[model samples]
Target chain A: MSDGLSILLSDVDVGPRRHPFLRVDHLQAAAGECVGIIGPNGAGKTTLLKLCCGLIRPNRGTVLLDDRPVGGWRGWRGWQGRRIGYIPQQTEYNSHLPFSLRDVVAMGRNALKPALRPLDGADFEAVDHWIAEMGLHDRRHQTFRSLSGGQQQKALIARAMVAAPRLVVLDEPAANLDTRSRWQLRDIMERLFRDRAMTVLLVSHDVEFLPGACERLLLLRRGRIETDGPRDEVLASPSAADVLAEI
Target chain B: MMDAYFIPILIAGAFAGLSIGLLSVFIVGMRMPFIGSCISHAAMVGAVYASLFQVNPTLGALVLSILAAAGVAFIHPHRRHFDANTGQAILLAFMMGLVFLAVALEEGSRTEMLGLLWGSILFADWGTVVVTGGLAVLLVAFVIAFEKELKAVLFSRSLAAVTSAATEPVYLAFLCFCGLILAVNLKAVGGLLIFSLLVCPAAAAYQVCRGYRSVLLAATGFGAMATTLGFLGSYVFNLPTGACTVIVGTLIFGACSLVRRALAISE
Candidate 1:
């Protein structure tokens, strides 16, 4: 409702046959807020994330980013890539690709730069900083597919944050991570939210991986929001308990 | 010893090999190797139709192959409803049938038509050499100019789009490049065998290399080597040039696989 919200989805409908696979009447995330969206399988969580990232357009209604309609922005991809970092689900990665972890992370900067130009000193510095921040300095030169699941996740997170975007969107970031890696990811998310004041929209199936910095919770079921409120209140609600039970 | 006549043939063969080899890295990386075969067959249909109509077969092949690429690109937007491989397969069968019909309907010497099916690189003219060489240069420039975007798309189109690269246009351009390369190489490698040249060298390089840049360099080297050796073998044994080239490429891939296995065991 507020004009200053970072992301706003209003009366959105998406999917085949106009079937309304994801119908969110209204959702708003203010700047620097961390929101966690949790739901069971086939609940449109990933689709919502894709829509937010401009990877998919809503079949109907409007998605506004930084108070601007996403569909109206000329060269929106350039805008989105520079300002809105997106970490897609691990399943979206192709293991057969020949990119090393450093190469993968460097793509964050490459996305913003012109196609023909090589990475400059600033780009290299940013890539190195994130690689070290993610504790992947030792594995930076290794092929991405050769890394363990947790290591790969860390690399992906580093890639998403390397550009230092104002907003970051992650889809199931902790899906296959080990407990220690999940905790590390939690710390990273907290640091991004608290230190940098980066707005984050995180989608997850497991509530256990939700970072402590998440101030808002959204529970989706069968393409509709089942609960949306303050994180602690939603977690204490019976509806949230039922949703987690079904998962 | 290579003579004046063999000079044009060798140059054409090498250039065609390099162009197709560079494009093959993208085709193989995107996991659409079958689409290459389909595009070559579409070129065959165009070549045969041109022979029947008395038009320039190379130009005709370029048009048809581009059309086929466009068809594939068009069908991609509806990928959930229609699989791209299925569309390519359909296009391949349709083109094969059309090629046969065109050949059957032709009143002139069908040797030319047959030549398109099984290339005669040894008989290549200087013009063919020049065109193929030009294409080879253009392809290298293209790779250099769009290396980052190409790598992102090859890794994953969806992820590439999310990262803000315009994947659809890049994908369509890639498909068009594949078609154009197939069309130009029709004289040197033949429609039936060009796809093997496109796939084998890149596949061999993929087995041996861990980085994309290395893969591109290794595939180009393998391709040029296979093509030159195949041309020499064809001259020595009086074998089909196109078939010999494909055989050599496949053998290289096999050798690379063996080397990879040996290295893995040693590690």
Candidate 2:
């Protein structure tokens, strides 16, 4: 309903047992903010993003998106929870089902439809518009798996946008892409921010992966946030460069 | 083909093939071919148990397979202690062991048991025709009604749910329908070869088809043609219908493979 999502994480602790311990005593991102999350490999950045996306539950505390519970009680992601568009790491999808890029992008409307309803002309129009927006119209008929990694990543971004999400979260979108493709993605990322006043959360090891719109940075290490401030201020932290290099 | 007695069987074969052909796409796409094997064995276990109680084995087969399918569909893969394939293999072996035990303990005639385990299309009655036709219609209708949602879950159920697609109930219902369809056909197609019908045609379609709709249409067409030919095989050669159906399906796969190879060479 709002132009963007306002996120709040309060006293959140996840998987203190079988997995690495992740705790966020307090964190908040206002509407339309571009926040970059960078941390070491074991820093629980993915876990934190998963929490924000309602993919996992916190053991100790709650995540609130726009003042509503991140994921509803008893593991139901309510309307508020559904407004967040999440593109997980590429490796997370275990199976490739040979869907065309067009069909795959159309899946963004899936979360918005009722149970028995098929996507309509309007949905396809949105899909086509985003496909053209992402410059993937020529290859819309190609199987998603047949594309290059950057192309697939672009398709995923298009997939996230079709839902008209208030918050868009991507985890390592440019991880395995070539230098040229990564730079291309950076342009798209900047364009995405410039076109919409929506919240964006990007998790990447490469600081340069963050778009120029990224105004704030959170440096995480060993499941803890060491620096949470403006991009320049966090980058200016004495330990930020060393930690970023190690991860 | 127009004979009064043979009409029901011909209708049953076409409808059954149509439904099974559609399900094969999901099974193949999920990369869980083992689930089919497990369901067939589960149906066998149910059949043997029904024989133990002097009841019609079809009833038991339907109930047991549906129950087993629920476990496979409803439980999240990550929640399990082991891999999905491993769990299915374990379930299949356990069902096989149970089938043997039930067979050993029972003193009833083996005729009904054999009929269920090795289905004969010639014995298909109007009742079977109705059940099979109903399942086929339901599967087709479900696919149409839930096209977008079904595509999402097929792509990846978790991703669909995370994106806020109401995939859980739809996915569970899809699996329920698939289980029911497979069980209903078990009496006419045999427990062993039922899985072939559910996988072979769809897999063959993948060799040339570019999209989901194409595969669905092609698989169903292949299935209908194979079933018709198989019926003729029974009439002409007096061989087992299931074996004939499997032979035709294998031929289809082989031809498709050749087509793929030829296309590759040309390219």
Q: Which candidate should be chosen as best, given lDDT against the real structure? A: 1
Q: What is the TM-score of chain B alone in each candidate?
A: 0.95, 0.92
lDDT of each: 0.82, 0.81
Span of ten consecutive residues with least summed lDDT in model 2 chain B? B74-83
Residue A67 lDDT in candidate 1 = 70
* Shift of residue A149 alpha carbon in model 1, Å: 1.0
Instruction: Please provide TM-scores computed only on chain A for all of the candidate models, following their numbering.
Output: 0.92, 0.94
Worst 10 residues of 2 chain A by lDDT: A72-81
- Residue-level lDDT tens digits of model 2 in B1-267: 357888888889888778888888877777678777778778777877887897887788889988988877745653344677888888878887887788667676777666666678887889988888888888888988888877877777667767763677778788778778877787777877777887788888888777889888888887876777787788689898887887887788788889888887220
Please, what are the lDDT tens digits per residue for candidate 1 over residues A200-223?
Answer: 899988887888888899999999
Candidate 2 colliding pairs: A111-B164, A111-B165
- Give model 1's docking category: acceptable
- Per-residue accuracy of model 2 over A67-88 as CA lDDT, tens digit each: 7776645346456334667787
Error of 2 at B127 (Å): 1.6
What lDDT does candidate 2 reach at residue A198?
Answer: 91
